[model samples]
Target: MKKRVITIICFVLIGIVQSNAQVTFQPGVKGGVVFSRLTNFDSDFMTGFYLGGQLAIKFNKLYTLQPELVYSQQGANSNYSDLLIDNYYNESIITVNNSVKHSLDYLCLGAISKFSFGTGFHVIVGPSLDFKVNDNFDKSYFYSDSPIGFDFAIVGGFGFSFPNGLSLDARFKQGVVDIYGNNYNTNIDNNNNGNYDEVVLNQSFQLGLSYSFDIK
Candidate 1:
């Protein structure tokens, strides 16, 4: 998967360089803090950040499509009582109490549709695909491991641009796909040696700053 992504990026870059459009294409960096949560598990936000570049293609005076590749961090943390496993019928109370920390990181690819409001301001909305790079379950009350999964999200944001080719953007993104991997027995090893890991699909919100260059 990583190799394929690299190949695609290389091809895109080559094509851009070879194009003969009168429009300008400027690529710049983006980075900002993110707050995320896992549904059905925890409700607290995890602090994360992202840094990436965008390839913007200008179309006339009103709109453009920007494709971005960013390394983003997204996840959540829950208190021991949040799982509500402390009842006799609830098994895994011990495990839930033991799970102290958990997190997920993703490599994301997204496309943003820009509607220029003129005077260097634009509204952006689009879709993103997230590939989990790592998921961690840490703490004593639970198992000593974590699971892997993928995420799908929709993005919307606003920004301001400078006539000199610099821009500032702020966006909010939400996950529309279940982050959960699957369903299985809540019991760890059939014999109930431990508790089965629960996967939660959650929503993420981000406030980001990005710089864009114009190519014409």
Candidate 2:
């Protein structure tokens, strides 16, 4: 998987290297709603918004390489019950029900390759780098640490374009990095290595609309 990601990046870099030649440029704006959740937990999906811009470099009639910068908000809500825990003073055992809302904000940078087929239908595949800007959860809540700072993910989708430069796409993003890597609370750490024995990843689906302006 790592090797595949490296190969994709190399191809994108090659595209950048070729930009010195003549090409077509299209500047675009995009916005979407994200249905996001944290995997490995029974949590409800959180609906958030994303807004971004993209610059599309057209190499030929059927291909374009687009670079985008986006701001996205994501999170989930979880309700857990029947938990046993020692008191803060380490004196007695107590049962509690915990409900939490995890919220995160990120700045996402992506290089997406767009492949157009017949009749304006197209497919997009890309790699994304997400920088954690802010999150509502802290270390005390996780009993280990906050969520990871940077996340790597793959995004792919299909869309249709209109002659007016309006387009719509639906994409799914799967995180390659775990939100909690080897850090677990006593409730989850059975091996005492702070390992939860499982990985927690970010999964989300996006529906977006974009409009582009042609430039010389």
Candidate 3:
């Protein structure tokens, strides 16, 4: 599967490079701290890290399209009791400990449109395809079945770049897809309000430092 994906990426990059020879390509590497959690579900944020590389296809000074491949670690810490998981019986109460953690690792493929401001500041917005590489969750927890292996998310961020190729950026990623495959969706009150919405969506904030190398 990785080989197939790499082949497709190579073909796409070649096509893109051949479309315009005058465009500059800069390769960059990044490492970041990630604060992530599942939306609602009485979950708390967990800290992780992400590392990746990207290629900046610069069309001009103001516009550039960046494609990146990153490996990110993220998840949430769930500490709630008396979860009514009526999967087998009419009323089943499962007491989850405070230390139950959902650890997830994802391989993220993304492309963003970067717009530069007055000097070195830039804003980027894009979409990402995240594939779950690993997950550690109890099978008989609040989720009835296994979580989905893929997620679609939108990325929004801002960064400042220096002439020496150093940059600092922050990004917020929100998952649009509900990865929770639970059959019982209307039972729990995650937000402690009167409404009940047990939708499971991944949300994260990332702060990163990067350095780019000019390709000649």
Candidate 4:
């Protein structure tokens, strides 16, 4: 009986060691383009890219935690509807006459939860926080304030990791908050006097690749 117990204890210890050996602590980088669009906005889709790195810690057979940092682009496009009548004395009417394009850039930080199904396959889901880095706007219209809103988004994706520590991933990010401020009024002033003009939001889809480090 004593001998049998010793054998069992040894087997348990060996199994624990083997289990730990299967896990990896890794760092990786990813980049890809987002085919993006804002729902209900005039512009169809915006193309942009994201580049970033992640620190991954494997906990067990099915789960891992990864924290990431990336530079991402986000925004929307719209057709300018009217030309603003410049004369103050004349009856003011700003007719919606043309189309416009705008863009916003962000430095994003995210946390991802990974669930692995088998060798080299995994699914990742998480949330991201974005800080506005820059903005691009069309020259013709005079928008009084910065149109960028929504400081965060929920992101999710799936991909696989190779034995060499390289990983490939495709992700989707969606805004949880309204990107436009409540003060924005889209009313058209027919008299051409400069007043509140309607504006649209830009949203899009992103597809990309990520490379991870191998831990031995």
Highest-scoring model, lDDT: 3
lDDT of 4 by residue, 164-202 (tens): 777777877876544555433334357644333333433
Off by over 4 Å in 4: 1-23, 81-99, 137-143, 148-150, 181-202
Off by over 4 Å in 1: 1-22, 81-99, 138-145, 183-199, 214-216
Model 3 agreement with the true structure over 1-216: per-residue lDDT tens digits: 999999999999998888677688999999999999998667889999999999989887899999999999988877766555767776677765546678878999999889988689999999999999988775435644567898989999999999998989999999877776443444545664533356678899999998889778
Per-model TM values vs. the true structure: 0.68, 0.74, 0.75, 0.68
Local distance difference test scores for all models: 0.73, 0.84, 0.85, 0.72
Full candidate order by lDDT, most accurate first: 3, 2, 1, 4
Candidate 2 regions with alpha-carbon error over 4 angstroms: 1-22, 82-99, 139-144, 183-197
**Candidate with maximal TM-score:** 3
lDDT measured at residue 36 in model 3 versus the true structure, 0 to 100: 95
C-alpha RMSD for every candidate: 12.2, 11.0, 12.3, 8.3
Model 4 weakest 10-residue run by lDDT: 194-203
